[model samples]
Target: MPPRPSTKKPNSNPLKKKGPENKFQRQQQPQQHSKEEETPFDNPTNTIPLSLQQLLLNVFQSALVPNTSTSQDGKQDASQRDAIEDEGQLDVKPLIQTIKSHLYNRDFDSAFTDANEELLRAYALRWSASRTLGYAGVFKAVLGILSGDKERRGAGGQIVCIGGGAGAEIVALAGVWRDIVALPTDDMNGEEGEGEGEGRMELKVTAVDIADWSGVIRRLDGAIRSSKVSGSKRHPAPLLPDGKRDKFSVTFQKADVLSLPEGELKSLYGQGTVMVTLMFTLNELFSTSMAKATAFLLRTTDVVEPGTLLLVVDSPGSYSSLSLGKSEEKVERKYPMKFLLDHTLLSVAEGKWEKVLSQDSRWWRRDAARLRYEVGEGAGLEDMRFQVHLYKRL
Candidate 1:
């Protein structure tokens, strides 16, 4: 009677209708949308779990994350988690089995190729960070020794570095030299004054190893360029009384620790102020003929004058088992740091070199739990401690 006004139903559009099927579809849509939006962590294509991802993320963040207020708690949390990850627990049998099977069944070459890439990647990451921090530690020690009144007396003067890889430590030490020698003590103390009458000392560095000559040269060139760009002052004019130009000079030679070149040794560093550093290279040197290796150690003292300073930094032998065991068949082996030190000290003593500093224990331990969490079971922690020895040629 009212012209069916209500029955016409406000001209409802079909699209706007809420039918049973529409309601059912609407209810299902959210679930489908959620599935499509899943994150890689949630649906990882590989066996790596979310917890492990968090752990790795924590490690990277801890190492590289710039310090900030919000990050303080994170840093602590990451450290604690890393400690747990370092423990010997947590099963990796399955992962190892998977890898072995893949290696044995598939083309062995491909499998090995992949594994090597992964290994290199891991080493590069860890070494880059550890080396940077470690170099900082070394430079701090050097400055402490250099700044002290005793060091300036030219008593116990040469610094020796073993196993100088990529020469990063050398670069860092050069920077320290620039900072110490270039800056007046007043500048170091955060105040400017009439520059002190202090003069810069001559630092003669010798880098020796069995690595490719080209690679070593490239690294040295880069380091020198970097030091120059950072505004390092060239050694002051008027050569020292010893007739040695007081410039930053480094001589690189290709010498195997096993059979060092005696002639080259005499020509490059025949008695002057020197400092020696040995890094991650001792193990390689040790595996060679012990007699030859011992001779090299003896020659270090022989080549330098009495009271030269020697600093040797190397990893403890514990971690060698992890990586070395895998490649043992291909490479010769040697004892850990303790044994190496015992032998080295005996050799040095026989060679008449006096030891100034010797620490057999390691200062840094790898977070085993974190490594296992990332690499899974077969992986173990490597102690990065060094038996630092400061020797005077005597």
Candidate 2:
């Protein structure tokens, strides 16, 4: 029995077959062959060049410059001030060339990294400036509230700053309050016979952001404390000749703009008149989902009392999309300025927020000029466009 030859024969084909030969299988084989013929670079990871990496790094380093103010005597010196003032004054040709070179060198990863840093820095600086201006305006409005004449102030107000990174914008707003509203009162000597400068004016500000970003938060906290200490030491006299101290209140808290906590909102605002600002932060929200972003805005608006103001400042350039490139072929797509504006405007409208004021594009160009180059030619002012909108609650 053991010596008997084995009866089993090896099967010629192990693969499943519908028939001896099927057209579908034959067709699939050629398609597979054609796919194999394609170059490895067709894969996304392989196609990205090394040059892009370097470009991204350079852009990011450029953005880190403004934060340097923290290390430099805690106050901007004349040179630093001049540089900041002239931010958007220079040509960005050098920056473009540097980025182009990095891309040509196939360092895409580095280029993207650097670009993200630069974008964050740019956003920080822009928010700082805009916050300063708006704060000044709001402070003036607050003064009107204190003024015996009713027409100057349009109801007492509260301000909520969203994505209030590092609190630079908030600090700047506080500075404006100290200067225009606080200092002026201190200058006036209290004397009933002299005149009626005898009352305190108060304004409240609340800053909110999603992440801890402890470094920024700490720096801001220190700056605020220092400002207050400096003001107290420098001005012993009351703002009003009547020996009254004008009160300016500021509260900083961690919060998620997408899903705001109701208790935090009530504590910060307390039914007082409100104004909201989403400075350079809407883009992050937009990146997640435009519909979701709009919903967040709508929800925020719904929570606030009627007649509140919402200020939105965002870059209107196809820069992000251009960087991401095309979806199908991985080719770069040049997005026109118009396309960016249309997209941003559509989002705002979708949120059901009506635009009260929209600034010209030149402001963004000015901001870009402020960017300084540490590694490569910095992005020029002309390469960017920003639109600021003030939407009043209906």
Candidate 3:
């Protein structure tokens, strides 16, 4: 004490200002932190094989003109087929307008004819593909969160698409499963490569729709099987092992999903992880009748097992107008799609469904410059802004 008194002050530092005035300044200084580590789902890859898109266009054209080619050889009939296909091509603008009018008039039965579906595919396949990317991103984000806990890594499950007969969900789910199986991981010994396929699980997609889209789904499945990993600048080589591509099965059921009996609904998922999806489908059901939609969901709550994941994606700010009563006593009201979905799923029981993720709007776009094929002016190959809600059955 005597030495300190003679030499220097005990609580003073020359490097830092010594006063009550600097007390707040010290707390305001930025703290040093180590850089954060990146996770597998940090950046969800949205690229699809160029071959898939090209094949899709071909399929659409062929479906639109079933008898375009009678020749046996491809080279011998290439020009003939092209001319016939071009002639068979319907004007995208008017076709889509007609379809929209039918939909608006609440005549869904007339809008989904075989020819109309093909035309719709030609006009909207790219948009659907873009939406698939959005869905895959959400799937990865959810799976990534579940992966943090060792016991909850069984997030890989069967994908049941309520009205995904157009085949976007098929492609998206298959690609996600392929990437997940091919992703490398560390083993118990802290080594990489061995964890690849350690959690390998087969994906089964059940597509339930009111239309006969089985033919289209089959063609898409064939295309995906034949799609090779093109090591291009835009789509780099995939992580799949040599001679291995995505292996999955798709089952299409042509029926009104909402009208399916509880036993049939329960039969859709046979154990294992089950992720049900309603992509661009729920709004239509609500537009038809909110009462029916509500009843269907409540029935689902009673039928489905726990640990099920329900994923809903639709246009942002989707609204439906309801008219009740007859003649002069009619009353009409407009309701948002998200509000109705939340009310139905979350309010069914005390804890029937737990909302895992919700996004009001997320933009998904396809860069025209990266496309391998030429796009027509009125093809409607634009971007999509969608809302996504993910729920878990408790």
Candidate 4:
């Protein structure tokens, strides 16, 4: 067969790449991978752009097949493995029940998929992964706004997203870092070239969650690195003002938000303009107990200084049914405001850290004509009561 004709016009003066490729470069930066124990996603095949659910589903399907060795020792080892897995499964029994209720009730009204397959694999997958682009824009705008609080304007800071599985927050920070370095300073009114090198900064983000998201995140980071390293005409990574890639590193840690160790919060964040995000997790926590959920919210606020930014996203509905319903009947609350109005927030409001951004998803959709953001594709509007809030300590 003959070679296909080129669709894109060839550039006369293409830029050359002068950075590290995926595995080799990753090896050079030992501190970045020091905390993680998983193998690096070096191969191109591992970098395919698949959703977290699909990747984990493939992992599960692969695990179902028996190993090649079928001797008596192998059988014993398999039994031991099964016993360990069963022990872990005991903790998720309640979650299994919830999945059963959702499926049996035929309540496909949620923004996430209604398929039985999806329901079964929900534990390993990230249900909120589809909001990648939307969150990227939101975080970009936010970092732009916070540029002033910088150690230097538009240059240095850190971002931490709670429950940021599958690298959604990583992608968002990467987009923001690139824009910061390439584009002129947002506050500067001069031409593009005026603020050159002013926005170059180092950013670090920590994704805290119980499930291991290293595989998917490594795949994405590897893909991006490969794209930048090749400087290929086929697919190129966006370059910074200095024609270099930004050092936006993402690290993952296994943690339970509600029960994080005492003082671990302060040790992790330190004293800086750290932006802590509790997206999608608050409402999920409320499924069990609002009191415990409120405790989780309070503990998050305890670590930050007067200027730390707290971003929250969750469903919005009255928890009155949960609090006021029969003693035996279970009612899971959906409102973020309830957490706000709870007595716990009173401590946080010590005449400081006022609420800044408060936008309900329903309100945005209801009045789309006057909205600031274009809802991403297939992001169900009605089912998700996606409310976003930002509080900055004074």
lDDT, candidates in the order shown: 0.40, 0.40, 0.55, 0.43
Q: After superposition, how far is residue 29 of candidate 3 from its true place, in Å?
A: 31
Looking at candidate 2, the ten consecutive residues that score lowest on lDDT are 9-18
TM-score of candidate 1 relative to the true fold:
0.50
Give the CA lDDT, 0 to 100, for residue 217 in model 2. Answer: 41
Instruction: Give per-residue CA lDDT, model 4, range 1-394, as digits (tens).
Output: 0012223321111011232123243123222112242221111122222222122222221121112112121121232122111111222234435655664664522312323322323332223323443454456546655664545454466777777754556654664555454444422222244565354566677887655556545544543333222121211233222344455667777666667776876666765546888666555556546666677766666667766777765554424224556878856445445454333443444444455444443211122222111112222112123445556655
The digit string of per-residue lDDT tens for model 2 on 234-316 reads: 33211111222235456667666666566665665567645777665665565544455656665666577665667665554
Best by lDDT: 3
TM-score per candidate, in order? Answer: 0.50, 0.47, 0.69, 0.56
Candidate 1 deviant stretches above 4 angstroms: 1-129, 146-160, 184-198, 213-246, 317-335, 346-351, 362-385
* lDDT of candidate 1 over 66-102, digit per residue (tens): 1210121223332233221121232334444544566
Write candidate 3's Cα lDDT for 244-316 as tens digits.
Answer: 4544667888878667777777777656546788888888888767888878777777767786778887777
Residue 80's lDDT in candidate 1: 30
Regions more than 4 Å wrong, model 3:
1-106, 113-117, 123-126, 143-156, 183-199, 228-247, 324-327, 373-377
Q: Rate residue 44 of model 1 by lDDT.
A: 15
* lDDT for model 1: 0.40
Off by over 4 Å in 4: 1-129, 150-155, 182-193, 228-235, 238-246, 316-343, 346-349, 362-385
> Which candidate number maximizes TM-score?
3
